[model samples]
Target: MALAGWICLAGHLCWMTLQCRSVSGKVLEETYTKWLKYKDDCLRQIQQDPQPAVGLYCNRSFDLYACWPDALPGTTVNISCPSYLPWVQTVQHGVARRRCGVDGQWVQYSEGELWRDISECEEDQETHTEELWMKQVMLSFRVLYTVGYILSLLSLLAALIILLSIRKLHCMRNHIHANLFLSLILRAVAVLLKDSLLDQHWSKPINTHADVQHILSHRAAIGCRTAQALMQYFVLANHYWFFGEAIYLHSILITSVFLDNSKCLPYFLLGWGTPLMFVIPWVVMKLLRENKECWAINENMYYWWIIRVPILFVSLVNFLIFMKILKVILSKLRADNKQRYPDYKLRLAKATLTLIPLFGVHEMVFIFATDEQTSGIVRLIKVFVAVFLNSFQGFLVAVLYCYSNKEVKAELQKCLRGWWRWMQTCWEDQ
Candidate 1:
């Protein structure tokens, strides 16, 4: 699955790069031709009449008596003239004919005007470099995601092998098997959808005006928006489920009473349903605001602040819960191994040093970083980080807990070995 995802992402990026390059090349050619024609006309006009005044038009203002000398044809020079045109002269030297005002009007000087208007010509060069950088960053992220995906898939596969090849690990205790199955299924779906939809060609190509309109329209853009919203909701739900697993584990270890709680149901509902509310508001705002883009314009910072507040609260709550659990578990473990093994203190220290940085500090940094950004590359990176953390959380938890247990590890190994042997034999026969 990881290999397939990489292949798909690579192909998509190549296609997008080709399309962007083609469009940029055409724009550059057209802009260059237009600039050449304008330059030639200006030069011809200047040669015919040396003192000819031309009007230079810009965004919201215009210069009426802009002069064009034969030496610098396409460029504007300051000119002084009659009652209508006011003039001011700067330092006058050999070749430097520096005059300030043009006609009677005080000419407005803009630094930006002095800069060449080569946006179209420079776009391909600029974007090509940007594209390469994006590709490299994306490739690194894809590799990271692929590793996580493969590990999760392997965990699921190991679980299947346990169920089929052995009885020990498959034994039903406190609905652990059911929880594992559901978690695996959810993780698989989340990874697959994310890898497929948001990977590379997520945004459609804007070839023509109609294509741009379609991309921004209510219907077409809704799907991408919906997918994004759904991904967010599922990610939250995945974490909620992992928290449930921890709670379940605690219940089993401390009380030995597994209370079947459907409390997770409401969480699941909110996780899926609440994001729909955000979507309605977004759609309404998009429609009423009449933006060319599908998503909310986010012109009002207040709207973003409002949206971010709840997410910030939820993240804080989750972080607190995680910290509290870690503290409790470590405290218990330390008390258990107080005197018999002095090295237990060393182990606990190592665990604290490792887990605190991995789980606690990392999550806090991610939450804060994500909340700081609006929509852009920063936001995209945040989404990627969030998804990666959420998807890999279950596997990490399983490893931290089950992998260290001798009985669990033994059962897993036996099951995997048997399954491998069977597959090897079958392959040999084939």
Candidate 2:
């Protein structure tokens, strides 16, 4: 019986350590908010002052029961977070026990009013590394996302202006390109607002997890929520455009059928209109079902999952289509049939190569990244890869589909020569 009890205790301790390792900002914030609320609840008890709750300690152990100084003898409490301040459990001694002392002042930490011990908040090497890794991944994402999204937005706009300026550039593919670019622009704007406004939203510096949670909970605006929805909608829309491109390529390559206006009507509907199938339902669900302050916009809850499910499906379908296109291209290459119709086949092949990567089928590589635990460096690298693929994809599309086109180069050269000639004429007149 003694051995069994020891084994059970050890198992429980191991479980605690597992729970405490590798924390997330959201979970930490939520747990801290709850902890603060608990303190506030206690302070309100029997008309007690708020200050009483700040460092309220009891004879009870910190890890297993009530924290206030006057709790019953058998009660236990859990001590977690950093020794200075913690909202949730971490690998840093996440689960420690504190039992109430019979004499009524929580187990000693000081000679004066400070009162209480947190000596057990020690972390093992693995847990310490996990904590560092989590911080590294977060810092990487924060820095990379801000830089990549902003620059991608600017380049996307430049590409759109170039495409729209020349009369000869108008075609079904350009129409698709225009829509894709617009989606990216809106998504970038939405993400920029969300990221940029985060700091200014709260008056305080948000030094703790609880502070972050509090600001996130209260920072809901109709405009911001709508922008979030719009961003998600457009993000999915852009992916669909990639799927559309794959389908178009598959058609042109396999069947040799050009994308004409009549054939493109369905593609347009699928590209521009299909996202509504997901976004409308998400918006309606957010407005009608969710009563919270944030309204499930930034919260990756039910509505967000609804958006994600279709995107995952769209990604899978596009990948299959892309794979099929590759097979056909490889078969064509092996046959040497391109020699019979060199120019047309070569252009088609070049177009396929240029546009394939921009479709973002490669994003699947990072989809399951967070599902498993890895070292911090690996996580950061995966984040960089995913961020680069998703964020800068629009810029790549703009460059490949519009700027790099032979016709666009000729048009640009023509415009520059005309400007040069006008300058010379002005000089002669002078």
RMSD of each: 12.9, 9.3
Q: Which candidate has the highest TM-score of all?
A: 2
Error of 1 at 291 (Å): 8.5
Q: TM-score, each model?
A: 0.51, 0.67
Model 1 Cα lDDT, one tens digit per residue, 157-241: 5554445455655443323433543455465665566445433323555333344335334565454455544554454444444
Which run of 10 residues does model 1 get worst, by summed lDDT?
82-91
Indicate the TM-score of model 1.
0.51
Model 2 per-residue lDDT tens digits across residues 1-430: 2132223323333333223222323343444456456655545652553333444345221221223334544456554533323322454546555455555444444553333344454445587576556656666676777777787789889888877887777777777677778777777887777554433332334333344455556343444466567777788888887777777766766764434534668787887888989988988887777634334324545565787788888888877777777777667665665466546567557756675665667767866544344455686678677777777676676677667878879887897898899999999999
401 Cα displacement, candidate 1 (Å) = 5.1
